[model samples]
Target: MNVELSFMLKKMLSVALMPWSIAILLSLLALFFLYRHKIQKAKKYLTISILWVILISWAPFANLALKPLESSYERLENIPENIEYILLLGGDRNNRAWEALRLYHKIPNVKIITSGHSLHDPISDAEKTATKLIESGIPEERVLMQAMAKTTFEEAQHMKERVGEKPFILITAAYHMPRAMKLFKKAGLNPIAAPADFNRPEETGYATVLQSKQLKNTERAWHEYLGILFYKLQGKI
Candidate 1:
């Protein structure tokens, strides 16, 4: 029971990360100040207002932070010689999932695994990914789904139970790969990372990359940065 409670905390902590940004942070502090002199009702209203924005942007914030982490797995070099299974992580987009499925089609006798959970994400993450892979002419038998996992740690742990004695390739965003790999390692699964969906730097100037969108990107990067730290503290990785 303590373990399950801790897992839930980590999951919620991942979403709460967006509000840790300066934009939301300052807004929260300002509201706290504004409520200091106000009635209880005013304090409640302000609290509600802040929570709403935080919830609304959680997904986008996650998406933003994940950009670079998503890119870390991208390999310009040709495929290495010994991969036997490919594991794709789930998110808003199936970018890595599609890539893994494609690789499955190209390779010989390799299997694909999709790990996900139906939590805040309404769409079935692992199942949706598996559906696509099966549609692509890869035999249904070659795909494995670990649908019960909601966190990166559980995803890797559960995947190991399903996949044994195969050279596995784990696909996820580059920034996320670091933490995911750590979790996979802790789970006793050795997986080579395959990252996708990079948030690239501008060749011309840093200014272009520092636009509002980029600031948002940094907010997301900060989230992943902080998230990894917390995971480390908890030994979740």
Candidate 2:
């Protein structure tokens, strides 16, 4: 079953990156060659294989999936003065939690929902986030932690259930906002976005071009976009 799943994932990756026409053509050629030859033919496929790997793994292409999230975040004016809670998605260490917690402090009487998957009993990220907030002087009673959610969909679902009739913010990486918002919306949560850790913010011209992080950022962006598409196809998000 693991082998079958791996093979299916490999097929998805190849189909996602290569155009349908090319994949079909290659499949037909591969089938033709599979008829009688026990030994694999010659080596002409290596160059194409290398190019595909490079394109799939490289930076700017990766951000294809993440850019829309970045744009959604840039559209907000100051934190809406009436936010009820702030939902911080877990995955990062101190930085992401701190950034969201800062906002949690700013809004008057704002509750916080920190969500993550806990592999251990006593070491949840939700607890870490809550502990940090309490140390930061926010009352312990005001912070809420949702620790059972392991994936974005489950995180949003948990938040939606907890957030009954409340306005909240979804804080995550700029590259992740697009898919995060989509999932939250689907889960029936109208969480506002508070995206952080942007590689670039409103800069134009050659600056975006020459920065090393741009490529890195773009790669991350595309990964999320690919994930969103995959989830959509699977009806998981």
Candidate 3:
């Protein structure tokens, strides 16, 4: 499949898999069943649909679902010796760039590769992040911006082309690390997972259970799960 087409498809898939989209879809399906006079089936579907929305929106349930993905790999206490590059994937999230900066501070000689494509925005994510890194005291010479990759699979491919077989730390959100690792490996790059942007709650309580952030977290978790499945189906990982 063409790269642009794949990127668009993945974006569409992400929107469709979001919590609100899934809830709306389920509710619509329930209505259809009801119209067909399958009362029991309609009731079952409606009940599940409502509960699914509520649970995903609820903080406790969302956190529970996200915990496994966030904890899939532990954070590195010390940068391993001889790592040449720190590969940061592109997203609106700032934690990824912060993580890259942290690694750069630890390994001052390591090159940084910020990869992301220009979607609807005039500035590519890579360039945006690269600028931030430079402003944060990273020398411009040490930062490389790869502005052609719009997805994790593309990021792996581009990184491999730029630094073939060289060891690099792959930095992304904690929930996204698993899929990122698989794609990087498939692209034949040596990636050391450097997950960041952990969304885990520090404590659990009655008030925490009703927070709106849970809905967003659940949506993010679902996005990763769906991305993994789609990538597997496409043989990208």
Best candidate according to lDDT: 3
Task: For candidate 2, write residues 1-237 as lDDT tens digits.
Answer: 674466567556745654333434555555555564622631233345444444444445445534566777763448877888888788445378767666765788888777776755677887877787778888878878888766688787777678765768888887788888888887777788888777553334332343445445645665676768877987866
Model 1 misplaced stretches (Cα beyond 4 Å):
1-8, 19-22, 31-78, 91-94, 120-123, 203-212
Q: Assess every candidate by TM-score.
A: 0.72, 0.68, 0.87
For model 2, state the Cα shift of residue 89 in Å: 0.8
- Per residue, candidate 3 scores C-alpha lDDT tens digits across 99-211 of 88878889858999888788688988888888888999989999998888677787888888888998889888899999899999999988899889888755565455445
Q: What is model 2's C-alpha RMSD?
A: 6.6
- Residues 139-223 of candidate 1 have per-residue lDDT tens digits of 8998887788767777876777776645578777666777778878877887777776566643333223224544455555766
Least accurate 10 contiguous residues by lDDT in model 3: 202-211
Give Cα distance to truth, residue 164, candidate 2, Å: 2.0
Name the regions of candidate 3 deviating beyond 4 angstroms: 30-45, 205-210
Candidate no. 1 TM-score: 0.72
Ranking of candidates on lDDT, top first:
3, 1, 2
